[model samples]
Target: MKEEDIRELELRAILEASNDNIVIADGKGKVLRVSPNCYSIYGMKTEELVGKTADELEKMDVWSPSVTKRVLQDKKEVQVMQHTLTGRSVMATALPVFDEQGEMIRVISFSHDLTELRQIKEDYEELRAKMEYYQSEIQELRDKDQHMDGIVLKSKELSNVWQLIHRVAPSDATVVFLGESGVGKNVFARAIHDKSNRSKEAFIEVNCGAIPETLFESEMFGYEKGAFTGANKEGKPGLIELANKGTLFLDEVGELPLNLQAKLLKVIQEKKVTRIGGTQTKQIDFRIIASTNRDLQEMVREGKFREDLFYRLNVVPITILPLRERKDDLLQLCEFFLDMFNEKYKTDKVLHAATINEMLDYSWPGNVRELENLMERLVITTENRVIYPSALPFHTKESQSEVFELETEELPEQADNLQEALRDVEIRWLKRAYRQYKTTYEMADYLGISQSSVVRKLQKYGINS
Candidate 1:
């Protein structure tokens, strides 16, 4: 065979074996040759396309916007995306071959199928959109968690209270929170205020009980300059006036004197406030949230609280359950407080399981406030990193007595001598008493011994309070 014929055969074999569709076109845009793979991309055999021009093939809907035609017109390399009649996507590139005279001689085009690539890209875009949407939803949940302000809604009672808060937060109706002294009434008041439309404005808090009866009027209602001897010279805005376009949190409203109850009611009814000694009335737009630990109805019956004022403030009443009733939240609350104070005080304290069990048994009379304080105290004062039951201030005698019984039950097996066993029993009881009582006087009273004897015994036993 001739050398030129062998090279021609090799070139044809290379073109037929290529994964891409190869096409050769004349400078005038006439197709001269096509690779065997042309059928897969353009859905046409090589022989059917060999004699056709790019314009004719485009007109036949084989592939739109031909790169070969673009290369012929521009006399340079060109690339384009083409859609085939066979429902395939392809990326085609064409380059012109020039002679020594710098005139274009031929255009060689190569096309790669892009149908699967396009589908994969589309799938990636869809997944990215979904991931972004989920991230935004998670961020929204985190924002809501920040607004919770350490409140644990594990119990059904608190969950119901939260539902009520959600139902009433959007409105401007007066909300009164009723609960025991440490049941987090103020915390609920703040939650509602934060969820309301006026969250961006000032939240003026007034402890009606903390303010004296003599100065309650002046403090609640602002006074003009020189209105009284001790009044601010530039005049002062009272709690009510300061709460304009915001929330007025009247904490312990039941302590308000009878004279001021009518006045507060008038302000709530009219949404206006006047200075203590001034006649000019200022129009106020504010939301009222009152919290109290007292029974206002009983006070009204006893002629202490005005019925009309009580009725006015009781538009939306929300009751918060004490901590003891919400026992499910105890462990979560303990962990929350531990994390908070540990971060605050730079400690790594953890609650022992026994301590948690003891906490579950105790009745928290002081409610969440007491628990919070106790956690803080334990975190600061505990010598070890783990907080145990012996570190807690409040423990029932029944629980401590169980420890005594367990210790005595093992005395016979553990003790060697009778005197040593009796001494061991005394030491254990004294230590138990020390753990149960805060002072030696209380321990002495419980043991029916003198205070001096209790101190001496505790000293001998090396027990420290």
Candidate 2:
């Protein structure tokens, strides 16, 4: 063959061997030829595409808004992203081939498949979002520095509780906390775990009342793959297993079902747990810290709670008084929560003197949690530099009336000497307040006196808790 024909043959072989789709068309946008790779790349046979115009391909629904037609109309190179009917993404580079007269003679195009790259990019973005979500949740769980700082301790009652915590936290003994709901039983559990030798390990907290009865066993003991319908295919570890070498805080333990209570007592005694629907038993080493607002002894008497489980769990009991019972901590707690809400909502609102007195005088049935929520509300809704009693959702007038009724009850019969008569009346009133309230701090708050004064009078009156 002649040298020009050989060169043409070599060029045709190179284009056919290329991985990208190569197409040659006349200046009128009629397809003259396409490389064999067009079938693999664009899902269209090269022979079928040959002699087909851009308008013909559009009518056949093979390609939308043909790049070759764009280059033909403008007589210039055009690069565009195209999606074929077969759901393949391609980058189409169409160039006009001009002769010496500066007029377009033919068009050549290359299509680079970008489907895999797009899929990879989408997968990366999805993974990044999942990582961020998990990271935030992990930070919320493990950030003890934030949690420890939030607890308020400003009274001798709480100071004594802290001393007890220090005494028992060094040991791996099971501790049971008794308190009203939202009184920070979980906080005390966390403090014990943080002070223990297993502080480096996970402190898994589970609410016995929160888990469903049907899922309680699976959640506590885990399950093997195909253990039951809808079970995880890869199997899962339970909260007990997760708490190995750490602390397992079971809040609202009094709410545990009788059957599960037996199972839990067994796990505590045996130090081993068997997964649901599996024969294998795993040995575990974890500390137990249980809390409940309910009286487990009363439940045991009524046969609602297992007596064996109660004795096993109640090795050492710590009673956390309600906020009304520790009124001295109220203002400090209010200030702490105010600071937290100020930082959270970016506000500088201060409490008015009347608002502080209203907070002090009112009986907080919801305890510290209520106060925290109130501070957040004031921070977000207060329109002035200071938060006033008018901003309170509850009526301070009604609360003041309740306080007055509690204090203004009729005094006992009088004595002979005027001073002696006053002292006798005061003692009777103090004794009545003590009987009415659950704690000395609460009596002091109701009588508008200090907790220390209440203690001193109780001591003088020979009163016992």
Candidate 3:
């Protein structure tokens, strides 16, 4: 072969082997030649691109702000970031090749694909933003948990209750809390008092059921010195008087005798109390917060409770739902009490997954108090660091058996093959976990699987997480 022909073939081989897209254009920006990989970068065949001008290709949206055009116009090297019709991002640079007479001869451009790098940068930024958002949410939840006064307010029902409490706490509207025993009525009553303007003053809790009938009058309304035997030498203030400028929580108000109920009603209505065997009536200023588990309306209809007194105390009634109905808070409550007792007793006990599932299934009849008590018992009695299903009390599993039966009864009809039956069970569990937990991390923890596996299985089954 001739030496010139050999040199031309070598240059062609170099252009073909180059990784970047290389294009050579004339001084007027007319395309002269393009490397084979130019098609991949611009989404056009080499033959279609060879005869096209830079301005024509730019109009076709092959690549915007052509580096070749810039190099040709400026007669110098130019670099630009270009977006191509192929949906590829590129960093393109063009250098003008000048003849010996200082006249432009050609423009040689090189383009490096940046699509994958740009995508990676975007994904990193999105993940960073999500992390910040999740961290803020977690911190907010921790703050709420610390200040809730041993109350787990995770459920929507409890959130509404908190809203109602805030609305009524600012006013002294004679609030009353109605719920089953151990539903944290006393805690809520104290919460109301603390949220009020009189929070700086005394909060006297009077259990009407615990006071004896004979002593109820003196206990509620103080006795003067020497009024009766065993009376204090100095005049004593009554419970109502002691609560002046503060809150008086009357726990189990329904247990008060009908005669005493009349007196209590007078004290609430008049905001004044007269000491026993005393002639002068004393003025009082206080807020009344009452709670009762019994049906005072039924008592009034049965002639056991005074009707007028019932109306006076039933002004702003707040009913707290039982723990069974607010299952969303059960896991948090359990973990809270467990951590509390663990610190109190200096133990390190963790609940196993099975034990947690069993606890979730059981219906807590005794409410939060029962759950607290059970956690304390388990923390104290469980021998190992991890408390498993066998550590659960017999009554808990017995109660859960009915729920388990109901859940199992609704299972899909028996499949002809074992594989189908197993798949049906898997789908049922996935749906149940999805409904019970708020996040995939929680679902994975409850279902005893990796988070990635949970996501993949959910996608495979067409389950929307």
Candidate 4:
């Protein structure tokens, strides 16, 4: 072969063996040439893309947002990483080709398959999303940064309770909220429902204490039109029916009568409920959250409540401590409720330090509910820019037990007159030693209580702590 023939053969070999996708197109962006590398990237042969316009690969699902914009805008070379019109990832280089006189005559595009790199990128993105979800859920369980609407809180005791609720709410267990009326058992129930699998369904709450016995059956298990003398004409679906796939909170469950206990038991045991004076039985699926201040277990022993139903309903127990026991959470809760009621009442009456101290000192027998009511009353009734201790409904007094233990100071001598105060000091030091000192010896030195005394108190308190 001649020398030019040899050079032409070499050029063809160079183009065919090239690793990058090289394409030569007309000035109008019609493809006229394609190199071999185009195959690996686009899942197509060189000849396939040669005759098609760059815009014609719509069916392949490739998104080819061309560097055409950049090149056209700047009238210069452009480099871009984009998915092809057929959904293939490519790193592309585009430039305008000019004629001998410097007038634009053609356009050339070169691309390389970056599908593997793109796959790696997508995998990272999916992983990042999963981590974000896990982190959010973890935060919720800790109640550290708890959420209400868009709010986040870090109340210590409240966070502990929030985390416990998240852990317990998902089970098929029965939860009995122990709090004063209006302490927000209903809110807790709603939170449980929100975290549960049945979140997509209804949430029904029935106040057993509020409704009379005559209407109990109609309100809970449904009723035939004539089942009661004055029932709805077409008949009404009870709360049980309305709460088909979600949760039903029996507030004041202590008020449910003895006769109705048997009925409610049947519904819980068989997952079915019967309508009053109606023969049909319906299968029921739901979780139960019951709340009351009454001692159901004690009531059962006293013959006021059924033993079997009490056992069944106590599947998963969460006893809410009264606000007095969780004094660590009082200030935090006060601040939160203040901000909340401020928004509701559209007022910014700040609580005075003395009033806050007074609020903290009182033993809230009614728990959070009572505190909320007191705050609402103060907010509504007070006209001053600041809340005063005088605004409190009653004088702040220490609980009887606390009042009995008050002393001028600790004594160095053991006297019968100081026995009760000294005993209180001994108990306090025992707790402080075990928890804070992490050793009995150090606690004994601090409180002048013996290691043996600490040991005995720990046993009396039934503490392994």
Candidate 5:
């Protein structure tokens, strides 16, 4: 073949093999040539469009608003999205060809099929909406879970105590909480009231020790109008009267004087109260819950507390153990208090692992209240994101060793032989070590015993930890 003819044939082959749909039209908008791929993009054979005009193709319903016709009219390049009757979406660009005299000769158009891309974009949008909906649902469920799981108590004894509180909360029984100061007695009292049938009513709390001896009767039962000197003229209800149909929590009930104990007992037994200097006795309906760190039985024996009142108030007794004994719940309480102070102070502070270990090793004599205060102080005083042991307010050499010393108790003297005495000592040490450490491996490491020996001793001694 001639070199010029070979060049022309190569150019024609290049046009036919293009990935995009190629069409060549005359300046008058008559289609003169089309690539074979036009069948895939426009659902039409190339021969059908070879000799057709834009006006004729419009009648055949191949494409609307012809790109070639637009380029011919404007005598410039034009790009547009196209819709064909065959339901294919396409992007088409048309350019006008000009001769040396600046006269329009032909128009060429390139088109890309966009139907699959549009479908994929639609699918992605739908999936994004579904993910957003599921995320909202998960957040809602997590909030509900936190609410339902009220107080954090992990020790077996404390867990049992919580279960007992729930069981007795539905009734109108008088409950007495005996524990050390700051051992969360009031918290348990509120929990009981919240879970009871009278939850909708007010839960009134009174510190019996804070009230004066002379005003104890008037403070507990409402005084009538002008009943006493300096009393409210309109007559105000007292703690007992204010707690009608609800729960009255008398904290430090052991502080009530011997003379007033008889009167308080009469009011509780009869469910009626007579205010100071008042003639009429009014009926009161309420549940009474009392808490005291003192031993009421010892007080009764010592003639400081009334035996009758003690029996009346002790319908169900729940004693909360000190914080040092329930070591399993230390981390949980720390997280709760950290979250509380973080929200209050608007700071995101976290405790370091060493700081947590130090807290676990210290004897918490002030119990949950002390931990809460310490967490708040750390958040306010510590400027860094992580809290270290040196920053703790109670960090000291004595405090670090206090927990272990308190865990050990005096040896029982009843053992007859040296071997039996050694066995008793071993049991006591094992029990204390188990309470301080979480796992058998930890206890073994702390006590200088093998892990297998720790397990065997725990099983032999009937220890459930």
Candidate 6:
């Protein structure tokens, strides 16, 4: 075959194989051929859209790329962004088709729908911001009162965590955040979305445990204007609808009622929802990130949670260590809370050494939220920053627990068996702390040492980490 005939066949093959919605426009901008993908990309049928002029397409918000116009004039490829008749956002790249004579005989363009990609990107960016700010804050938290997860530790465990987060921050995978209550799962969820591709979209949070069973469907799926007597006149959109093209976080998801579990499963599976009293199904493009304190697998066996959902959400599981595991960070939280309260109350005060010592001894059962409340209260109740043990709510408890501390107490210089006495003191302190706070990291803070140091000391004396 002649070189010219071979080039024509090559051009035909290129047009046929393109996955993008493609169209050809002669120099005068008349429609020549539209690719097969064009119908699917526009959510329309082909026969209904052939032989339309560029002006006719403009009525449906379709037009050649600005660059395409330049391409036609300059005989080059041009890219365009426009909305299709079906409302899908599209991007088009128009390449001028030439004959053997090198004259522009036609323009071939490829287009793609960017709705899902763009929405996910928006959600991702929003989640990334959350993760970035909080991840950075962990290193800077003040001592005494702070969220455990918000506190950064100089440990391989935490180093691994940061690395893992960075690895997983870019996708829309359903994440199952595993952590104890008050370990900041919700915060991490927000961070994931903020750091993700869906950052520009809305981030909706749903606490499954908080929504009652009878109203779960209506609350989550929404209802029409007259669906019920109390329904909004304009018909309320469900959380799913509100979160369209964004992120929907299910907090305490293990607590979701069983009757509604199937509904959630459908949404995750089909990516479509039918609001209450509404017949039409609306397709959604959103990412799911769920957090839970309860053991979902155990619940599945107990018939309280679904195993399928668990498997689906576990695509990416991030487990956060409890506050007790990161003892190196306790003082940082204390100072963070102290400064926060100081600024809020406009007080120029400092922590009393004795008061801090007492605080370290008491266990924080309620986690970060508990610590924050304590600091705020202490700051408000106390007259000065020179906080005395008496100013704290747990002072009496600490005094009572002083007996436990004596067992592991650091020996006095007056004692010849100093090391043994100090060992006893440490044991007593650890016991008292375990009884008060559920976390060992909290105990380590009370002793004012790295948690591993505590573990090592205890191990030397036959203690558990």
- In candidate 6, what are the lDDT values of residues 1-465, reduced to their tens digit? 999999988866876797777677676666766666676666555555466656566655554333345567778776767666666777777788788988887766667779788899989999999999987787456321123435444445655765676577688788888887876678778777777888889999999899888888888888888998888889988898888889999999988877688889989999998889989899999899998988888898998888888888889888877666654445556777788788989986677555676666666666656777888888888875476666777777656445233323455556468686675666665665555555557667766778887677767756454
* Residues 1-465 of candidate 5: C-alpha lDDT, one tens digit per residue: 999999988868977889888889987889998888788767789888889997688677687668988898888999988888788888999999999999898999998889899889889999999999999899777544333433666678887888899899999999999999888888889999999999999899999999999888888987888997899998878788889899999998999899988988998999898877678888999999999999999999999999999999999999999888888777778888899789988999998654787888889989888988898899999978988677776677664454344233565689898898888988877886776678999888766889999999999988864
Q: Each prediction's Cα RMSD? A: 18.9, 25.2, 12.9, 18.7, 17.5, 26.8
Quote each prediction's TM-score. 0.58, 0.55, 0.65, 0.53, 0.56, 0.54
Off by over 4 Å in 3: 1-90, 93-107, 110-147, 395-444, 451-465
Candidate 6 regions with alpha-carbon error over 4 angstroms? 1-156, 397-465
**How many residue pairs clash in each candidate at the backbone level?**
0, 0, 0, 3, 0, 47
Q: How accurate locally is residue 62 in candidate 6, as Cα lDDT from 0 to 100?
A: 51
Q: Give the per-residue lDDT of model 3 (tens digit) for 170-219.
A: 89899989998888999999998988899999999999999999999899
Clashing pairs in 5: none
Better of 4 and 6 by lDDT: 4
Q: Clashes in model 3: which pairs? A: none
Model 2: per-residue Cα lDDT over 74-108, one tens digit each: 88889998888788889999999999998788999
Q: lDDT scores for all predictions?
A: 0.87, 0.85, 0.87, 0.74, 0.85, 0.73
Can you tell me which runs of candidate 5 are displaced by over 4 Å?
Answer: 1-150, 397-465
Best candidate, TM-score: 3
List candidate 2 stretches off by more than 4 Å: 1-147, 396-465
Worst 10 residues of 4 by lDDT: 399-408
Q: For model 1, where is the 10-residue window of minimal lDDT? A: 400-409
lDDT score at residue 11, model 5, on the 0-100 scale: 65
Query: How does candidate 3 score on lDDT?
Result: 0.87
Candidate 2: residue pairs that collide? none
Model 3: weakest 10-residue lDDT segment is 399-408
